[model samples]
Target chain A: MSTDTAEKYHKHTPAPIDCNNVVISLRNIRKSFGSLEVLKGVDLDVCKGENVVVLGRSGSGKSVLIKIIAALLRPDEGTVRVLGKEIDQLDARELQELRSKIGFSFQGSALYDGMTVRANLEFPLVRNQRKLTRQEVDKAIRQVLDDVGLSRTIDQMPAELSGGQKKRIGIARTLILHPEIMLYDEPTAGLDPVTSVEINDLINDVQQRYNTSAVIITHDLTCAKATGERLVILSEGKFLRQGSFEEVFHNDDPIIKDFYNYNFISDS
Target chain B: MKVFFLRIYDIYQFSLRFWKEAFLPPYEYKEVFNQFFEVGIKSLSIISLTGFITGLVFTKQSRSSLAEFGATSWLPSLMAIALLRALAPLVTALIIAGKVGSNIGAEIGSMRVTEQIEAMEVSSTNPFKFLVVSRVLATTCIVPVLAIYMGFIGLLGAFVNVYNNEQTSFVSFFQEAFMKITFLDLFTLVLKSAIYGYTIGMAGCFNGYYADQGTVGVGRAANTAVVVSMFLIFIEEMLIVTLINTYR
Candidate 1:
């Protein structure tokens, strides 16, 4: 989205990429519910083993974009390809298999409150990997919990876990499947500053450990700075600017400058 | 009218989808059993209590009318037929429509509002099998048994109410109650109970699974589920009755 005076903002927008190495790709994605357009011909790609953060205001449709990659929502126009498979071309079973390779952490964590931590962690494997033995299941659970540092919460329910712990357990459950692409929706939205940083670190840690390509959707500047290898700002249902944090943060676009200035004020 | 038809079509498709998924591999019997225990076994106290009260009041009311006609001896047969052919199943289903229907609605509705259902789908699990099929199948399986139990319990209540003064024996009471139930009557009643059970389960699951995303939406779903299921029960029973009457 280039305007006559928007040269600085447009300068940092990403260049075109070779499609073969892309882990997730969207082309001219246009979606609308009723008369409101959410994504207007937006195109993005996440390379293998890279973290891209999408920053947007509330109601800017960041969550919808995240959902599109996971095939949780379909765009009225354009294409979504994840893990090299065209999403709309797959049948139900094939789509499910594709979904298993992608882990989505929702805004509220969305852990199954009916189940305990162990059951929540075990749910994906039990439902999908039916051939896993009991010992194997237990080992997988232990390994993931140990990885997330939540081993003792095995018997506890989601209601009992604090917000930070719930988010971790949510990630743990998704991680149990060893997904190749992780979609994080507001991973650090509601936590205190310290816990938010911790979750941000955890996101980075999980990305490196699992070798996952991730799309982190958040408004938290600290999170965007910490976890994102690349950042794209969504405004007016389009990618307004893209670059590293330093590049976009220092650029003199009025909209970009005002966003950083306001958030920086809030931070202090 | 169009919206009503669309809603009906949606429910029909949902039921068919459940049937399709139910017979496939990876059937979740544990989930089915849990829902059965929740929808049927757990509802016994309410069903039994209603059965007793219905039988008592029904027999007493019929006796008063029969006494005026000098036909009080017909009490046992009349009550027996009414309870077996209609009361037992209808009452049990209505109770379910209120208790279990609302519960199913709330459970699924809350999950939908909270995004647990979406998470399950994204995790590659079929929530239809884990959630809807089990609830629907459980009701279809367990409701008929519950209706039969209710019929027997109603008879016990009638016998207790008829005894001491009228002096009807336990053996005679059951004998008369059951003997009057012809095969056609039995079939119709069982068929009606099964249909009622399916309607209640489908209504609840449909409303719950399709509920909009909010706390208010959950409440609306539960309320709407009970009302719609009760309305369908009455309509279905009327249709079944008219068909049976014409057949006779």
Candidate 2:
């Protein structure tokens, strides 16, 4: 770590957290693909009902970090505890059971193109909770569609839906399971400003309504500012700045200043 | 060389996993049935056309040669031997390796690129059971049925040509054909068709499930599936023919 990065890390490192409230806790998490080290000794804590936005440019290990939390990808070295369970030690069945408590929303929406919106939502619900009657399944699907404001698109295939609508459906599919921790990978990416704001609002609504801790991964400052209660800027493989959105962005560091200028100026 | 060996190892592991997961409980019966319809019922028209044309053309082409030798009456038996032994199964396998193999590759490759497979995983649905095992099982079970259907259709086509040329009755032609065919030939046809189907399915699914790099990768996967399935089908055909011939 550079002198500037080390100082910033020491200065902004989070204080000890209450184990009861922390839904996800990672200490010294490290991951590498081939010889390319993507994450180097990363640490993070996501408290219950807290929204932590990880801000980073492309290829900066934002997605990898979240995948680690979801146990979709294992870390090479570190302790990962999600929902009070040690992620690295879980067997296949245990990991699956743990995964049921977390939802991952991919950037592309990842809706099954062959399935209609209703079937897509019912997929997770029916698979994880198999005892639900047909009426109960229909009710759950309807409720989630309503939550995402896409109730009318219940019978339509993903190909018929617009990009923003697909993203909404993707979130609805994840939310249908009522996961305790929601990992949103670039939730507002590739959406119009208006639609992005709507998604941001939906994220906040989910946080309040479901009392779910979430990790929002994005480089979009507007989304981070709107949805995140706490923000951390990841550069290279470490969190170089951490605090509230304004606190992290308003810094003397050249990298932070450049990122802020680039986003705002480019948008204008 | 190292990458090639690693890929071979990966495919071995993938095949082993499929065998292990396929027999596990909570099978995706609905998806498997859907794949049967997709792989079998949908390919009926093409298979019928090819089978009929193959029988009619091969019989007509062989008639003149047999006539020159004063053995034209043996045409029915010769046609039966060729179709039942090799033509029907080989043609059906090649056709399916081109059609269904590519379809499976592209569909699964697109899903991988779009993250639908991972989505299935996060939804607590075992994607291997739902997607890979279902399709593989459908192909393995359904291709033989199609091949048998093709063989009968080919016989009808041969009868049509024989009737046109020699005014031979359908009953007599069929009797002559059946006289030359034995139980082992039937067994070989079914066995060859099943092996080819399994090869096609495994090739398509393995390439597709591992596809990456986006749309270009999907196209590559589809192409590789067809090529690899066809190649394996030919090799398997040769090996099975040699093995069965030893018994004969």
Candidate 3:
């Protein structure tokens, strides 16, 4: 293939790897603190190029499940595999190597207050791939900044930006690594409706552009509707329901229906 | 009391895990270096500036008392020995433990409370390695450097005081100080200062790493770490004095 064609394919149409290419899989995962069982045998899967949304009320182990998948929290029992590598079995070095392929957008934006937006974007980039020439780093910065539509504010300190701009910068920083999978924890939590939609659309655009899988943890049904192809709901550390958006909306369970209807109007 | 014991256990376990994670690597050198810059180098000016003023003030105070005893000539040597042997390192470390310790505690505590540390974990980054190790290592290595720097500046301040107060020439003042100052005493001073640095840095970073209850918790950690480290430095200095007296 010509370089241009390869670049085009890389950006637009990645040769389908596998429709069921499970990017992340969790089986019989359990987590606890002292006597509190946080995640009770939670099982989940995100296929290649799928957007999986997890919904739950506060304290519902939705965030915990995502943490397990990302290898942030170790399960007291069971297995978590990402890209076919068992995460829990890997040592810290191996784990960091594995995490290089994953990008996480924090719920709070988590931009280092001491650093500017540009420096934050450059952080993982410089660490993971050290040989990128200065020009390449700058170009990568511009590209990711452009991707998140915050190129104009690249030099601004994180504190100088508005709430939505900070989120955009956070997303932009996550994109720098070109992760195979992107995990978002309450990406739209504190934003106004308009900015929330913009962030949701940005997540969608990233998925389509990179053919990346996503697992978004949120309580906002609107976010679930906009980003996830499949919706999974949790309660008391167990998977309460899981299906495609249509299957989930028409679910016989009143709890699921109530959640689906509640988000449908507010988001639309 | 049980809760108190549990908190101590929590801190001990955190330090243990931090060391294990930090040593096993794909080490985050950039983060460590960045923290070193923040915790060590950035805090240097205040420590040095304060040490200089402290030495000058001590000399001025000591001169008046010693003058009544007809021992005014001992001022330069006394100031040098006190600043070099004890005061500079102890004061700088207390200040550092207060300023940098609280800052790290707050930074890491907020990261924990906000789930930024969790975000790092899920991104496959070892939060301990990236956050805790880098911070501890930076403080361990950088605080010593700061101690040495502060000690030198404090000595210069003493020299300035002697030059102004007793109308002594720099050469005569230093000659007198050298006659009184032993190699063992200088060595002990450097050793104590380095120990003080390590103690302050480790305590501050450790408190921050395991901070609980959000911002209030971070504030408490920072405050407690400084106070505890300051107390420990004095106790350790006394213990060292006892050891040196017994051993020598």
**Candidate 1 local lDDT, B1-248, one digit each (tens):** 99989987997799899889989978889899999899888999998999988888898878878899988777777888998888998998899999999999999999998899999999999998899999998888888888988988888788888885589888887777777778887788788889988888888889999999599999999999899999999999999999998986
TM-score of chain B of 1: 0.96
What TM-score, computed on C-alpha atoms, does each candidate reach?
0.94, 0.95, 0.87
lDDT of 2: 0.89
In candidate 2, what are the lDDT values of residues A156-218, reduced to their tens digit? 999999989998999999998899999999998899978887888888887777768889999
Docking class of 3: medium
* Tens digits of per-residue lDDT for model 3, A8-119: 1122222244556899998999999889998989888888988888998889888778878877778999999999999867886788788888888888888877777788
What shift in Å separates residue A180 of candidate 1 from its native position after superposition? 0.4
lDDT of 3 by residue, B1-248 (tens): 99999978987787678667777757888888898889777887798789788877787788779989999888777876787667766777777777877777677777777666765654445567777778777776776667767776876788898887667887887787767777877677667766776677667767776678877887887787778788888898898888876755
What DockQ number belongs to candidate 2? 0.70
Error of 2 at B183 (Å): 1.3
Candidate 3 chain A: worst-modelled 10 consecutive residues by lDDT: A1-10
Clashes of each: 0, 0, 0
Q: Kindly report which residue stretches of model 3 are placed more than 4 angstroms away from their true locations once superposed.
A: A1-19, A264-268, B1-45, B122-134, B141-165
